[model samples]
Target: MTDRELDEILTTRWPAVMRRVIGDDSDDWMQGFVKSIARHSKRPSWRPSAKQAQLMQRLVADLSAPPEPAMELVER
Candidate 1:
């Protein structure tokens, strides 16, 4: 993908995906993950490597999928 496309996806779509996947109260791991990806877009002329592109595609896929049902606790 072009740098422009990468930038657009990271800037626009990724936030929504992160919100859905991580929620408002994100943990350290999730925060670190966001920072790592954010670094690419922050740099000049950023384009994802093959592996990063694959991972980004997977994240986009997650955005399309319906949220899974929350499990209810049973009172035994």
Candidate 2:
């Protein structure tokens, strides 16, 4: 899938779950956070705004669920 598609999914889902999981408000770290997310999503290019990137990071942290081993390995 394309990075844009992954962006849509992250933007749409990852934040609130991250909040619940980490008890931290990532709602303010969007800029570098988005870039960080793009790196993880393995996207070649994506420039989300600071607010947008923080949101993206939250989303990434949230929807990181997987079989079992991959559950807590999102940001390594």
Candidate 3:
């Protein structure tokens, strides 16, 4: 993948991370994770861990595949 694509991947995964670790998650854990990685990173880019990446990859594949129709389209 190109640098831009890599950045997009990281950008896109940000929401997935928050969804996984939503409310009741420890604040410090989130803050420190961001702060530590943020310090060295080029942007507020978020990269999922290996396991997370696998889950995200599967989620993406499942989403990418077209859904079966609830009912067939008919010609007018």
Candidate 4:
């Protein structure tokens, strides 16, 4: 994916979840975080590392999954 797409996913799409996991909700934290990741890229266009992308995709999937049903108590 492009750098902008990655930025969108990390910043716009899942800021709340990202902030919870990162424990830093300050302004522009996500933008700085994304820039740090993108800084290591060797490509002409910036992109997250494969591992980073995979991890983010997993987060998206986990977030998108339906919640499990609550178990009913069987009190005698």
The most accurate candidate by TM-score is 1
Each model's C-alpha lDDT?
0.75, 0.53, 0.52, 0.61
Error of 2 at 29 (Å): 17
TM-score: the better of candidates 1 and 2: 1
- Better by lDDT, candidate 3 or 2: 2
Residue range 25-66, candidate 4, lDDT tens digits: 435855465445545543556566688788666666666788
- Considering TM-score, which of the candidate structures 1 and 3 is the better prediction for this target? 1
C-alpha positional error of residue 57 in candidate 1 after TM-score superposition, expressed in Å: 1.1
**TM-score of model number 1:** 0.63
User: Candidates' TM-scores?
Assistant: 0.63, 0.28, 0.36, 0.50
TM-score of 3: 0.36
Span of ten consecutive residues with least summed lDDT in model 1: 17-26
Compute the lDDT for candidate 1.
Answer: 0.75
Q: Give the poorly placed runs of model 2, Cα more than 4 Å off.
A: 24-76
Select the stronger candidate by lDDT from 2 and 4: 4
Question: What's the ranking of the predictions by lDDT, best on top?
Answer: 1, 4, 2, 3
Candidate 1 lDDT at 51 equals: 83
lDDT of 3 at 19: 48
Instruction: Note the residue pairs that clash in candidate 2.
Output: 14-59, 15-59, 30-50, 30-53, 30-54, 31-50
Tens digit of per-residue lDDT, candidate 3, span 1-76: 3456446545675445444434436477654553443344455555556664565455445545676779987999
